[model samples]
Target: MLRSKKGYATALLASSVFLGACASTSGLDGINDATINGSHAQAQGAMGAGAGAVTGAVIGNQMGSSKAGAAIGALVGGAAGYMRGRSLDIKAAQSVAYDARQAGYQAEVNTAVMQNPQTNQSQQVFTGYRVLIPASEIRNQDPEATRILQKTAELAIQADTEVVASGPANLRDSVLTMLNLPAGQAQYVPSNDTKVAVSVMPRRG
Candidate 1:
Protein backbone atom coordinates (compact mmCIF):
# COMPACT_ATOMS: atom_id res chain seq x y z
CA MET A 1 0.00 0.00 0.00
CA LEU A 2 2.81 2.40 0.83
CA ARG A 3 4.53 1.62 -2.44
CA SER A 4 1.33 2.19 -4.38
CA LYS A 5 0.80 5.51 -2.64
CA LYS A 6 4.33 6.57 -3.52
CA GLY A 7 3.77 5.62 -7.13
CA TYR A 8 0.59 7.66 -7.30
CA ALA A 9 2.33 10.71 -5.87
CA THR A 10 5.18 10.34 -8.37
CA ALA A 11 2.76 10.10 -11.26
CA LEU A 12 0.82 13.15 -10.06
CA LEU A 13 4.04 15.18 -9.80
CA ALA A 14 5.02 14.21 -13.34
CA SER A 15 1.64 15.01 -14.83
CA SER A 16 1.46 18.31 -12.99
CA VAL A 17 4.68 19.44 -14.70
CA PHE A 18 3.15 18.98 -18.11
CA LEU A 19 -0.10 20.68 -17.12
CA GLY A 20 1.80 23.59 -15.60
CA ALA A 21 3.72 24.13 -18.81
CA CYS A 22 0.50 24.33 -20.78
CA ALA A 23 -1.02 26.77 -18.32
CA SER A 24 2.05 29.02 -18.46
CA THR A 25 1.92 29.15 -22.20
CA SER A 26 -1.76 29.98 -22.21
CA GLY A 27 -1.21 32.69 -19.62
CA LEU A 28 1.58 34.23 -21.65
CA ASP A 29 -0.64 34.34 -24.71
CA GLY A 30 -3.32 36.14 -22.70
CA ILE A 31 -0.80 38.68 -21.42
CA ASN A 32 0.40 39.30 -24.93
CA ASP A 33 -3.12 39.83 -26.22
CA ALA A 34 -3.93 42.26 -23.42
CA THR A 35 -0.78 44.26 -24.13
CA ILE A 36 -1.51 44.41 -27.82
CA ASN A 37 -5.07 45.49 -27.18
CA GLY A 38 -3.88 48.25 -24.88
CA SER A 39 -1.61 49.59 -27.59
CA HIS A 40 -4.38 49.36 -30.12
CA ALA A 41 -6.69 51.29 -27.81
CA GLN A 42 -4.10 54.04 -27.45
CA ALA A 43 -3.79 54.37 -31.23
CA GLN A 44 -7.53 54.47 -31.62
CA GLY A 45 -7.76 57.14 -28.96
CA ALA A 46 -5.32 59.33 -30.87
CA MET A 47 -7.27 58.82 -34.10
CA GLY A 48 -10.52 59.58 -32.36
CA ALA A 49 -9.07 62.80 -30.96
CA GLY A 50 -8.12 63.99 -34.44
CA ALA A 51 -11.55 63.10 -35.79
CA GLY A 52 -13.28 64.81 -32.89
CA ALA A 53 -11.34 68.02 -33.51
CA VAL A 54 -12.57 68.04 -37.09
CA THR A 55 -16.19 67.60 -35.90
CA GLY A 56 -16.09 69.15 -32.47
CA ALA A 57 -19.81 69.81 -31.82
CA VAL A 58 -20.97 66.35 -32.93
CA ILE A 59 -18.16 64.48 -31.16
CA GLY A 60 -18.49 66.49 -27.96
CA ASN A 61 -22.18 65.65 -27.57
CA GLN A 62 -21.52 61.96 -28.33
CA MET A 63 -18.64 61.82 -25.83
CA GLY A 64 -20.71 63.49 -23.14
CA SER A 65 -23.55 60.99 -23.56
CA SER A 66 -21.17 57.99 -23.60
CA LYS A 67 -19.32 59.22 -20.50
CA ALA A 68 -22.59 59.48 -18.58
CA GLY A 69 -23.58 55.97 -19.65
CA ALA A 70 -20.15 54.60 -18.67
CA ALA A 71 -20.36 56.20 -15.23
CA ILE A 72 -23.74 54.59 -14.59
CA GLY A 73 -22.51 51.20 -15.83
CA ALA A 74 -19.45 51.38 -13.60
CA LEU A 75 -21.62 52.05 -10.59
CA VAL A 76 -23.73 49.04 -11.38
CA GLY A 77 -20.82 46.68 -12.05
CA GLY A 78 -18.39 47.59 -9.25
CA ALA A 79 -20.05 45.56 -6.54
CA ALA A 80 -20.41 42.53 -8.76
CA GLY A 81 -16.73 42.60 -9.66
CA TYR A 82 -15.73 42.79 -6.01
CA MET A 83 -17.95 39.89 -5.09
CA ARG A 84 -16.64 37.76 -7.95
CA GLY A 85 -12.99 38.31 -6.97
CA ARG A 86 -13.76 37.56 -3.33
CA SER A 87 -15.50 34.35 -4.33
CA LEU A 88 -12.46 33.20 -6.29
CA ASP A 89 -10.14 33.89 -3.36
CA ILE A 90 -12.40 31.96 -1.02
CA LYS A 91 -12.52 28.97 -3.37
CA ALA A 92 -8.73 28.83 -3.74
CA ALA A 93 -8.26 28.88 0.02
CA GLN A 94 -10.91 26.25 0.57
CA SER A 95 -9.37 23.94 -2.03
CA VAL A 96 -6.01 23.69 -0.27
CA ALA A 97 -7.64 23.42 3.10
CA TYR A 98 -9.78 20.52 1.93
CA ASP A 99 -6.81 18.72 0.39
CA ALA A 100 -4.76 19.10 3.55
CA ARG A 101 -7.62 17.87 5.72
CA GLN A 102 -7.91 14.76 3.57
CA ALA A 103 -4.21 14.12 4.04
CA GLY A 104 -4.50 14.53 7.81
CA TYR A 105 -2.78 17.90 7.95
CA GLN A 106 -3.49 21.61 7.70
CA ALA A 107 -2.37 23.65 4.70
CA GLU A 108 -2.50 26.97 2.91
CA VAL A 109 -1.63 27.85 -0.66
CA ASN A 110 -0.67 31.08 -2.38
CA THR A 111 0.69 32.31 -5.71
CA ALA A 112 3.31 34.88 -6.64
CA VAL A 113 5.82 35.95 -9.26
CA MET A 114 9.60 36.27 -8.85
CA GLN A 115 12.25 38.20 -10.70
CA ASN A 116 14.52 36.39 -13.12
CA PRO A 117 18.14 37.52 -13.11
CA GLN A 118 18.96 36.53 -16.66
CA THR A 119 16.66 39.01 -18.43
CA ASN A 120 15.76 41.21 -15.50
CA GLN A 121 12.18 40.01 -15.84
CA SER A 122 9.54 39.04 -13.33
CA GLN A 123 7.43 35.95 -14.06
CA GLN A 124 4.81 33.92 -12.28
CA VAL A 125 7.02 31.00 -11.33
CA PHE A 126 5.42 29.23 -8.42
CA THR A 127 2.39 28.49 -6.30
CA GLY A 128 3.14 28.44 -2.57
CA TYR A 129 2.29 25.54 -0.26
CA ARG A 130 1.84 25.91 3.49
CA VAL A 131 1.20 22.70 5.41
CA LEU A 132 0.85 21.79 9.08
CA ILE A 133 1.33 18.26 10.36
CA PRO A 134 0.05 17.27 13.77
CA ALA A 135 2.43 16.07 16.49
CA SER A 136 0.64 12.76 16.90
CA GLU A 137 1.71 11.93 13.36
CA ILE A 138 5.29 12.24 14.46
CA ARG A 139 4.68 10.01 17.47
CA ASN A 140 2.67 7.36 15.64
CA GLN A 141 4.21 7.34 12.13
CA ASP A 142 1.11 6.60 10.10
CA PRO A 143 1.15 6.18 6.33
CA GLU A 144 -1.10 9.26 5.82
CA ALA A 145 1.22 11.44 7.85
CA THR A 146 4.28 10.34 5.92
CA ARG A 147 2.51 10.74 2.60
CA ILE A 148 1.36 14.31 3.34
CA LEU A 149 4.82 15.48 4.40
CA GLN A 150 6.45 13.78 1.47
CA LYS A 151 3.92 15.29 -0.92
CA THR A 152 4.43 18.75 0.54
CA ALA A 153 8.20 18.55 0.11
CA GLU A 154 7.87 17.19 -3.38
CA LEU A 155 5.52 20.02 -4.42
CA ALA A 156 7.74 22.73 -2.94
CA ILE A 157 10.74 21.34 -4.80
CA GLN A 158 8.74 21.03 -7.99
CA ALA A 159 7.60 24.65 -7.75
CA ASP A 160 11.19 25.83 -7.13
CA THR A 161 10.17 27.60 -3.94
CA GLU A 162 11.72 27.94 -0.50
CA VAL A 163 10.13 25.91 2.26
CA VAL A 164 10.16 27.06 5.89
CA ALA A 165 9.37 24.19 8.23
CA SER A 166 8.69 24.64 11.95
CA GLY A 167 8.29 21.69 14.26
CA PRO A 168 9.98 19.52 16.89
CA ALA A 169 13.69 19.07 16.19
CA ASN A 170 13.56 15.34 15.66
CA LEU A 171 10.49 15.41 13.42
CA ARG A 172 11.82 18.31 11.37
CA ASP A 173 15.24 16.77 10.94
CA SER A 174 13.87 13.40 9.97
CA VAL A 175 11.51 14.83 7.38
CA LEU A 176 14.22 17.06 5.91
CA THR A 177 16.64 14.16 5.74
CA MET A 178 14.03 11.91 4.20
CA LEU A 179 13.29 14.40 1.43
CA ASN A 180 17.00 15.13 0.85
CA LEU A 181 16.06 18.81 0.63
CA PRO A 182 18.65 21.17 -0.80
CA ALA A 183 20.35 23.50 1.64
CA GLY A 184 19.27 26.67 -0.19
CA GLN A 185 15.74 25.51 -0.88
CA ALA A 186 14.64 24.67 2.67
CA GLN A 187 14.83 26.36 6.06
CA TYR A 188 14.12 25.17 9.61
CA VAL A 189 12.31 27.28 12.19
CA PRO A 190 12.22 26.41 15.86
CA SER A 191 8.77 25.98 17.30
CA ASN A 192 7.25 24.76 20.57
CA ASP A 193 3.92 23.83 19.00
CA THR A 194 3.16 20.13 18.71
CA LYS A 195 2.41 20.48 14.99
CA VAL A 196 4.75 20.85 12.03
CA ALA A 197 4.03 23.84 9.79
CA VAL A 198 5.75 24.11 6.44
CA SER A 199 5.49 27.21 4.27
CA VAL A 200 6.56 27.10 0.62
CA MET A 201 6.95 30.60 -0.79
CA PRO A 202 8.45 32.01 -3.95
CA ARG A 203 11.61 34.07 -3.96
CA ARG A 204 11.02 37.80 -3.85
CA GLY A 205 12.75 40.56 -5.78
Candidate 2:
Protein backbone atom coordinates (compact mmCIF):
# COMPACT_ATOMS: atom_id res chain seq x y z
CA MET A 1 0.00 0.00 0.00
CA LEU A 2 2.82 2.40 0.92
CA ARG A 3 4.67 1.69 -2.32
CA SER A 4 1.52 2.28 -4.39
CA LYS A 5 0.91 5.56 -2.62
CA LYS A 6 4.52 6.67 -3.23
CA GLY A 7 4.21 5.84 -6.94
CA TYR A 8 1.03 7.85 -7.15
CA ALA A 9 2.72 10.83 -5.52
CA THR A 10 5.65 10.72 -7.92
CA ALA A 11 3.33 10.54 -10.90
CA LEU A 12 1.32 13.52 -9.67
CA LEU A 13 4.47 15.61 -9.26
CA ALA A 14 5.73 14.77 -12.73
CA SER A 15 2.39 15.56 -14.31
CA SER A 16 2.22 18.96 -12.60
CA VAL A 17 5.65 19.94 -13.85
CA PHE A 18 4.84 18.80 -17.36
CA LEU A 19 1.59 20.72 -17.45
CA GLY A 20 3.22 23.84 -16.07
CA ALA A 21 5.97 23.78 -18.66
CA CYS A 22 3.49 23.40 -21.45
CA ALA A 23 1.41 26.30 -20.22
CA SER A 24 4.40 28.60 -19.84
CA THR A 25 6.26 27.79 -23.01
CA SER A 26 3.78 27.10 -25.79
CA GLY A 27 0.88 29.48 -25.62
CA LEU A 28 -1.01 30.92 -28.60
CA ASP A 29 1.56 33.70 -28.97
CA GLY A 30 4.42 31.23 -29.33
CA ILE A 31 2.59 29.27 -32.00
CA ASN A 32 1.45 32.36 -33.87
CA ASP A 33 4.88 33.98 -33.78
CA ALA A 34 6.61 30.84 -35.05
CA THR A 35 4.26 30.64 -37.99
CA ILE A 36 4.61 34.33 -38.75
CA ASN A 37 8.39 34.45 -38.52
CA GLY A 38 8.94 31.28 -40.54
CA SER A 39 10.64 29.69 -37.55
CA HIS A 40 9.79 26.16 -38.54
CA ALA A 41 11.78 24.73 -35.65
CA GLN A 42 9.82 26.50 -32.98
CA ALA A 43 6.51 25.79 -34.63
CA GLN A 44 7.29 22.14 -35.04
CA GLY A 45 8.49 21.86 -31.48
CA ALA A 46 5.32 23.36 -30.16
CA MET A 47 3.19 21.12 -32.31
CA GLY A 48 5.09 18.02 -31.34
CA ALA A 49 4.97 18.81 -27.66
CA GLY A 50 1.23 19.42 -27.69
CA ALA A 51 0.43 16.29 -29.64
CA GLY A 52 2.83 14.14 -27.63
CA ALA A 53 1.59 15.38 -24.27
CA VAL A 54 -1.97 14.56 -25.10
CA THR A 55 -1.16 11.12 -26.46
CA GLY A 56 1.15 10.27 -23.59
CA ALA A 57 -1.26 11.46 -20.95
CA VAL A 58 -4.02 9.36 -22.39
CA ILE A 59 -1.93 6.21 -22.57
CA GLY A 60 -0.50 6.72 -19.13
CA ASN A 61 -3.90 7.24 -17.65
CA GLN A 62 -5.02 4.01 -19.23
CA MET A 63 -2.06 2.27 -17.56
CA GLY A 64 -2.78 4.02 -14.25
CA SER A 65 0.23 6.34 -14.58
CA SER A 66 -0.90 9.67 -16.01
CA LYS A 67 2.00 11.84 -14.82
CA ALA A 68 4.83 9.64 -16.01
CA GLY A 69 3.13 9.13 -19.37
CA ALA A 70 2.73 12.87 -19.91
CA ALA A 71 6.36 13.61 -19.11
CA ILE A 72 7.65 10.87 -21.41
CA GLY A 73 5.28 11.88 -24.15
CA ALA A 74 6.41 15.50 -24.08
CA LEU A 75 10.10 14.64 -24.40
CA VAL A 76 9.54 12.17 -27.22
CA GLY A 77 7.08 14.43 -29.04
CA GLY A 78 9.39 17.45 -28.84
CA ALA A 79 12.29 15.58 -30.40
CA ALA A 80 10.22 14.26 -33.27
CA GLY A 81 8.66 17.67 -33.89
CA TYR A 82 12.03 19.40 -34.04
CA MET A 83 13.34 16.94 -36.61
CA ARG A 84 10.38 17.52 -38.91
CA GLY A 85 10.60 21.25 -38.34
CA ARG A 86 14.25 21.31 -39.32
CA SER A 87 13.47 19.61 -42.62
CA LEU A 88 10.74 22.13 -43.37
CA ASP A 89 12.95 25.06 -42.43
CA ILE A 90 15.61 23.93 -44.85
CA LYS A 91 13.14 23.62 -47.69
CA ALA A 92 11.63 26.99 -46.87
CA ALA A 93 15.01 28.70 -46.83
CA GLN A 94 15.81 27.19 -50.21
CA SER A 95 12.51 28.39 -51.62
CA VAL A 96 13.14 31.91 -50.32
CA ALA A 97 16.58 31.93 -51.89
CA TYR A 98 15.09 30.87 -55.20
CA ASP A 99 12.46 33.58 -54.97
CA ALA A 100 15.13 36.17 -54.19
CA ARG A 101 17.11 35.21 -57.27
CA GLN A 102 14.04 35.26 -59.46
CA ALA A 103 13.06 38.65 -58.06
CA GLY A 104 16.40 40.12 -59.12
CA TYR A 105 17.83 40.37 -55.65
CA GLN A 106 21.33 39.13 -54.76
CA ALA A 107 20.00 35.58 -54.37
CA GLU A 108 21.31 35.61 -50.83
CA VAL A 109 19.38 34.91 -47.65
CA ASN A 110 18.16 38.18 -46.11
CA THR A 111 16.11 39.08 -43.08
CA ALA A 112 13.32 41.63 -42.98
CA VAL A 113 11.73 43.11 -39.93
CA MET A 114 7.95 42.90 -40.08
CA GLN A 115 5.45 44.39 -37.71
CA ASN A 116 1.86 43.42 -37.09
CA PRO A 117 -0.11 46.64 -37.06
CA GLN A 118 -2.97 45.15 -35.14
CA THR A 119 -0.89 43.42 -32.50
CA ASN A 120 1.99 45.88 -32.64
CA GLN A 121 4.38 42.95 -32.47
CA SER A 122 7.55 42.62 -34.51
CA GLN A 123 8.96 39.56 -36.26
CA GLN A 124 11.91 38.78 -38.48
CA VAL A 125 11.27 37.03 -41.77
CA PHE A 126 13.51 35.60 -44.45
CA THR A 127 13.02 37.52 -47.68
CA GLY A 128 14.65 39.96 -50.09
CA TYR A 129 14.53 43.74 -49.86
CA ARG A 130 12.45 43.90 -53.00
CA VAL A 131 9.58 42.62 -50.93
CA LEU A 132 10.33 45.03 -48.07
CA ILE A 133 11.53 48.26 -49.73
CA PRO A 134 9.53 51.43 -49.74
CA ALA A 135 7.03 51.86 -52.56
CA SER A 136 8.05 55.47 -53.05
CA GLU A 137 11.57 54.40 -53.90
CA ILE A 138 10.32 51.89 -56.42
CA ARG A 139 8.19 54.64 -57.95
CA ASN A 140 11.10 57.02 -58.55
CA GLN A 141 12.29 57.56 -62.11
CA ASP A 142 15.99 56.96 -61.37
CA PRO A 143 17.82 53.92 -62.73
CA GLU A 144 17.92 52.39 -59.26
CA ALA A 145 14.20 52.95 -58.98
CA THR A 146 13.71 51.13 -62.24
CA ARG A 147 15.58 48.11 -60.95
CA ILE A 148 13.66 48.12 -57.70
CA LEU A 149 10.41 48.42 -59.63
CA GLN A 150 11.22 45.42 -61.74
CA LYS A 151 11.93 43.29 -58.69
CA THR A 152 8.85 44.55 -56.92
CA ALA A 153 6.81 43.77 -59.97
CA GLU A 154 8.02 40.20 -59.90
CA LEU A 155 6.89 39.84 -56.29
CA ALA A 156 3.62 41.53 -57.19
CA ILE A 157 2.92 38.91 -59.78
CA GLN A 158 3.48 36.19 -57.24
CA ALA A 159 1.24 38.00 -54.78
CA ASP A 160 -1.52 38.17 -57.35
CA THR A 161 -1.46 34.42 -57.66
CA GLU A 162 -2.84 33.93 -54.11
CA VAL A 163 -2.11 36.22 -51.12
CA VAL A 164 -4.18 38.16 -48.66
CA ALA A 165 -3.46 41.80 -47.88
CA SER A 166 -2.79 43.23 -44.41
CA GLY A 167 -1.06 46.36 -43.05
CA PRO A 168 -1.58 50.12 -43.22
CA ALA A 169 -4.64 51.07 -45.20
CA ASN A 170 -2.93 53.84 -47.12
CA LEU A 171 0.24 51.86 -47.78
CA ARG A 172 -1.77 48.89 -48.93
CA ASP A 173 -3.73 51.09 -51.32
CA SER A 174 -0.57 52.72 -52.66
CA VAL A 175 1.07 49.32 -53.20
CA LEU A 176 -1.95 48.12 -55.10
CA THR A 177 -1.90 51.18 -57.32
CA MET A 178 1.88 51.23 -57.79
CA LEU A 179 1.91 47.58 -58.75
CA ASN A 180 -1.24 48.06 -60.85
CA LEU A 181 -2.82 45.11 -59.10
CA PRO A 182 -6.57 44.85 -59.24
CA ALA A 183 -8.74 45.26 -56.19
CA GLY A 184 -8.19 42.63 -53.48
CA GLN A 185 -4.97 41.34 -55.06
CA ALA A 186 -2.41 43.21 -52.98
CA GLN A 187 -0.66 41.48 -50.08
CA TYR A 188 0.62 44.47 -48.11
CA VAL A 189 2.41 43.49 -44.91
CA PRO A 190 2.73 45.77 -41.90
CA SER A 191 6.06 47.27 -41.01
CA ASN A 192 7.60 49.51 -38.37
CA ASP A 193 7.23 52.50 -40.63
CA THR A 194 4.66 53.61 -43.15
CA LYS A 195 7.16 53.94 -46.01
CA VAL A 196 7.99 50.22 -46.05
CA ALA A 197 5.51 47.46 -46.76
CA VAL A 198 5.89 43.69 -46.91
CA SER A 199 4.08 40.60 -48.13
CA VAL A 200 4.29 36.94 -47.16
CA MET A 201 3.13 34.02 -49.28
CA PRO A 202 2.02 30.66 -48.00
CA ARG A 203 3.84 27.50 -48.97
CA ARG A 204 1.61 25.12 -50.83
CA GLY A 205 1.68 21.48 -49.80
Candidate 3:
Protein backbone atom coordinates (compact mmCIF):
# COMPACT_ATOMS: atom_id res chain seq x y z
CA MET A 1 0.00 0.00 0.00
CA LEU A 2 2.78 2.41 0.90
CA ARG A 3 4.62 1.66 -2.31
CA SER A 4 1.44 2.19 -4.30
CA LYS A 5 0.87 5.55 -2.64
CA LYS A 6 4.43 6.61 -3.41
CA GLY A 7 3.98 5.71 -7.05
CA TYR A 8 0.73 7.63 -7.23
CA ALA A 9 2.41 10.75 -5.84
CA THR A 10 5.25 10.47 -8.33
CA ALA A 11 2.77 10.08 -11.15
CA LEU A 12 0.90 13.17 -10.00
CA LEU A 13 4.04 15.26 -10.09
CA ALA A 14 4.87 14.05 -13.58
CA SER A 15 1.35 14.78 -14.73
CA SER A 16 1.54 18.26 -13.27
CA VAL A 17 4.72 19.05 -15.21
CA PHE A 18 3.21 17.78 -18.45
CA LEU A 19 0.06 19.77 -17.94
CA GLY A 20 2.00 22.94 -17.04
CA ALA A 21 3.98 22.66 -20.27
CA CYS A 22 0.81 22.34 -22.29
CA ALA A 23 -0.77 25.28 -20.50
CA SER A 24 2.21 27.53 -21.17
CA THR A 25 1.68 27.34 -24.91
CA SER A 26 -1.88 28.59 -24.68
CA GLY A 27 -2.11 32.29 -23.84
CA LEU A 28 -5.28 31.97 -21.78
CA ASP A 29 -4.77 28.55 -20.20
CA GLY A 30 -2.54 29.37 -17.25
CA ILE A 31 -3.11 31.56 -14.20
CA ASN A 32 -4.49 35.00 -15.01
CA ASP A 33 -2.87 35.96 -18.32
CA ALA A 34 -2.34 39.50 -17.14
CA THR A 35 -0.35 38.46 -14.06
CA ILE A 36 2.08 35.88 -15.40
CA ASN A 37 5.51 37.36 -15.85
CA GLY A 38 7.12 33.95 -16.35
CA SER A 39 6.75 30.27 -15.66
CA HIS A 40 7.39 29.17 -12.06
CA ALA A 41 5.25 26.02 -11.88
CA GLN A 42 8.04 23.50 -12.40
CA ALA A 43 10.30 25.15 -9.90
CA GLN A 44 7.51 25.34 -7.38
CA GLY A 45 6.62 21.69 -7.94
CA ALA A 46 10.20 20.50 -7.47
CA MET A 47 10.65 22.50 -4.31
CA GLY A 48 7.37 21.22 -2.92
CA ALA A 49 8.26 17.61 -3.69
CA GLY A 50 11.64 17.86 -2.04
CA ALA A 51 10.34 19.51 1.10
CA GLY A 52 7.42 17.11 1.34
CA ALA A 53 9.58 14.02 0.92
CA VAL A 54 11.92 15.07 3.70
CA THR A 55 9.13 16.02 6.06
CA GLY A 56 7.17 12.83 5.31
CA ALA A 57 10.23 10.68 5.85
CA VAL A 58 10.80 12.20 9.24
CA ILE A 59 7.21 11.74 10.29
CA GLY A 60 6.87 8.29 8.78
CA ASN A 61 9.95 7.08 10.62
CA GLN A 62 8.24 8.00 13.88
CA MET A 63 5.09 6.13 12.79
CA GLY A 64 6.97 3.11 11.38
CA SER A 65 6.36 3.99 7.72
CA SER A 66 8.54 6.73 6.33
CA LYS A 67 7.46 6.00 2.75
CA ALA A 68 3.81 6.64 3.49
CA GLY A 69 4.66 9.84 5.31
CA ALA A 70 6.70 11.04 2.38
CA ALA A 71 3.86 10.55 -0.08
CA ILE A 72 1.49 12.52 2.10
CA GLY A 73 4.09 15.19 2.69
CA ALA A 74 4.68 15.61 -1.02
CA LEU A 75 1.01 16.36 -1.68
CA VAL A 76 0.83 18.84 1.17
CA GLY A 77 4.08 20.52 0.19
CA GLY A 78 3.05 20.92 -3.43
CA ALA A 79 -0.21 22.61 -2.49
CA ALA A 80 1.61 24.91 -0.08
CA GLY A 81 4.13 25.93 -2.70
CA TYR A 82 1.38 26.71 -5.18
CA MET A 83 -0.32 28.92 -2.61
CA ARG A 84 2.90 30.74 -1.82
CA GLY A 85 3.52 31.50 -5.47
CA ARG A 86 0.04 32.98 -5.79
CA SER A 87 0.51 35.10 -2.67
CA LEU A 88 3.75 36.47 -3.99
CA ASP A 89 2.01 37.52 -7.19
CA ILE A 90 -0.62 39.44 -5.23
CA LYS A 91 1.95 41.06 -2.96
CA ALA A 92 3.98 42.31 -5.87
CA ALA A 93 0.91 43.80 -7.55
CA GLN A 94 -0.29 45.47 -4.38
CA SER A 95 3.12 46.96 -3.75
CA VAL A 96 3.12 48.52 -7.21
CA ALA A 97 -0.37 49.94 -6.77
CA TYR A 98 0.48 51.43 -3.39
CA ASP A 99 3.57 53.09 -4.78
CA ALA A 100 1.55 54.58 -7.63
CA ARG A 101 -1.04 55.93 -5.21
CA GLN A 102 1.67 57.58 -3.13
CA ALA A 103 2.88 59.26 -6.30
CA GLY A 104 -0.60 60.86 -6.56
CA TYR A 105 -2.21 58.78 -9.28
CA GLN A 106 -5.72 57.47 -8.78
CA ALA A 107 -4.71 53.87 -8.96
CA GLU A 108 -7.23 51.05 -9.30
CA VAL A 109 -6.02 47.76 -7.85
CA ASN A 110 -7.65 44.38 -7.34
CA THR A 111 -6.76 40.78 -6.43
CA ALA A 112 -7.79 37.56 -8.12
CA VAL A 113 -7.28 33.85 -7.49
CA MET A 114 -7.57 31.29 -10.23
CA GLN A 115 -6.68 27.74 -11.16
CA ASN A 116 -3.88 26.98 -13.62
CA PRO A 117 -5.00 24.25 -15.96
CA GLN A 118 -1.43 23.22 -16.69
CA THR A 119 -0.37 22.63 -13.09
CA ASN A 120 -3.83 21.74 -11.75
CA GLN A 121 -3.25 24.28 -9.01
CA SER A 122 -4.74 27.48 -7.69
CA GLN A 123 -2.75 30.71 -7.85
CA GLN A 124 -3.15 34.27 -6.68
CA VAL A 125 -3.11 36.83 -9.47
CA PHE A 126 -3.04 40.60 -9.21
CA THR A 127 -4.39 42.78 -11.97
CA GLY A 128 -2.17 45.84 -12.02
CA TYR A 129 -3.72 49.27 -11.49
CA ARG A 130 -4.85 51.63 -14.21
CA VAL A 131 -3.77 55.21 -13.60
CA LEU A 132 -6.57 57.58 -14.58
CA ILE A 133 -4.81 60.28 -16.57
CA PRO A 134 -7.11 62.22 -18.90
CA ALA A 135 -6.73 61.96 -22.70
CA SER A 136 -6.39 65.73 -23.03
CA GLU A 137 -3.73 65.86 -20.34
CA ILE A 138 -1.73 63.15 -22.08
CA ARG A 139 -2.07 64.63 -25.57
CA ASN A 140 -0.90 68.05 -24.37
CA GLN A 141 2.32 66.37 -23.16
CA ASP A 142 1.68 68.09 -19.89
CA PRO A 143 4.82 68.42 -17.77
CA GLU A 144 2.87 67.48 -14.65
CA ALA A 145 1.59 64.37 -16.39
CA THR A 146 5.13 63.45 -17.34
CA ARG A 147 6.30 63.99 -13.78
CA ILE A 148 3.55 61.78 -12.40
CA LEU A 149 4.40 58.99 -14.78
CA GLN A 150 8.12 59.28 -14.11
CA LYS A 151 7.61 59.22 -10.37
CA THR A 152 5.20 56.28 -10.67
CA ALA A 153 7.77 54.27 -12.60
CA GLU A 154 10.46 55.07 -10.08
CA LEU A 155 8.22 54.10 -7.22
CA ALA A 156 7.22 50.86 -8.98
CA ILE A 157 10.91 49.96 -9.22
CA GLN A 158 11.43 50.67 -5.55
CA ALA A 159 8.41 48.59 -4.66
CA ASP A 160 9.39 45.78 -7.02
CA THR A 161 6.30 46.08 -9.21
CA GLU A 162 6.03 46.74 -12.93
CA VAL A 163 4.05 49.79 -14.05
CA VAL A 164 1.77 49.46 -17.08
CA ALA A 165 -0.14 52.61 -17.89
CA SER A 166 -3.57 52.14 -19.51
CA GLY A 167 -5.66 55.02 -20.87
CA PRO A 168 -6.49 57.04 -24.01
CA ALA A 169 -5.70 55.00 -27.11
CA ASN A 170 -3.16 57.27 -28.78
CA LEU A 171 -1.55 58.66 -25.64
CA ARG A 172 -1.46 55.28 -23.91
CA ASP A 173 0.27 53.71 -26.86
CA SER A 174 2.83 56.50 -27.11
CA VAL A 175 3.71 56.60 -23.43
CA LEU A 176 3.80 52.83 -22.96
CA THR A 177 5.89 52.40 -26.08
CA MET A 178 8.40 54.95 -24.84
CA LEU A 179 8.52 53.43 -21.38
CA ASN A 180 8.77 49.83 -22.60
CA LEU A 181 11.82 50.42 -24.76
CA PRO A 182 15.40 50.07 -23.61
CA ALA A 183 17.34 53.24 -22.86
CA GLY A 184 18.71 53.62 -26.42
CA GLN A 185 16.29 51.40 -28.34
CA ALA A 186 13.43 53.12 -30.18
CA GLN A 187 11.24 50.21 -31.29
CA TYR A 188 7.74 50.22 -29.79
CA VAL A 189 4.75 48.05 -30.61
CA PRO A 190 1.30 49.44 -29.96
CA SER A 191 -0.58 46.99 -27.74
CA ASN A 192 -4.20 46.39 -26.83
CA ASP A 193 -2.91 44.65 -23.71
CA THR A 194 -1.72 47.81 -22.01
CA LYS A 195 -1.34 45.96 -18.70
CA VAL A 196 1.88 44.44 -19.98
CA ALA A 197 3.60 47.74 -20.75
CA VAL A 198 5.45 47.94 -17.48
CA SER A 199 8.73 49.85 -17.59
CA VAL A 200 10.66 47.11 -15.90
CA MET A 201 13.71 48.19 -13.98
CA PRO A 202 16.31 45.98 -12.37
CA ARG A 203 15.18 44.85 -8.96
CA ARG A 204 17.22 46.04 -5.98
CA GLY A 205 18.15 43.48 -3.37
**Best candidate, lDDT:** 3
The collision pairs in model 3 are 86-124
- Tens digit per residue, CA lDDT, model 1, 86-170: 2233233334445567775666555343332212333443245567778677657767777766655655554344678888876
lDDT of 3 by residue, 1-205 (tens): 5665665566466545532432221111122223334323335656876897788778767767777778766765665554455445444445544555555555554434544433556555433334555545556766655655664454443334545444445665657543443343222334454232333321222
Against the true structure, candidate 3 reaches a TM-score of 0.42
Once superposed on the true structure, which residue ranges of model 1 sit more than 4 Å away at CA? 1-98, 112-127
Better lDDT candidate (1, 3) = 3
* TM-scores vs. true structure, each candidate: 0.44, 0.34, 0.42
lDDT of each: 0.48, 0.45, 0.49
Off by over 4 Å in 2: 1-64, 71-83, 106-131, 134-170, 176-205
Question: Please, what are the lDDT tens digits per residue for candidate 2 over residues 142-205?
Answer: 3543444344444434422223433455565555555565555455665546344444343332
RMSD of each: 21.1, 11.8, 9.3
Candidate 1 matches the true fold with a TM-score of 0.44
Task: Give model 3 RMSD, 1 decimal.
Answer: 9.3
The TM-score measured for candidate 2 stands at: 0.34
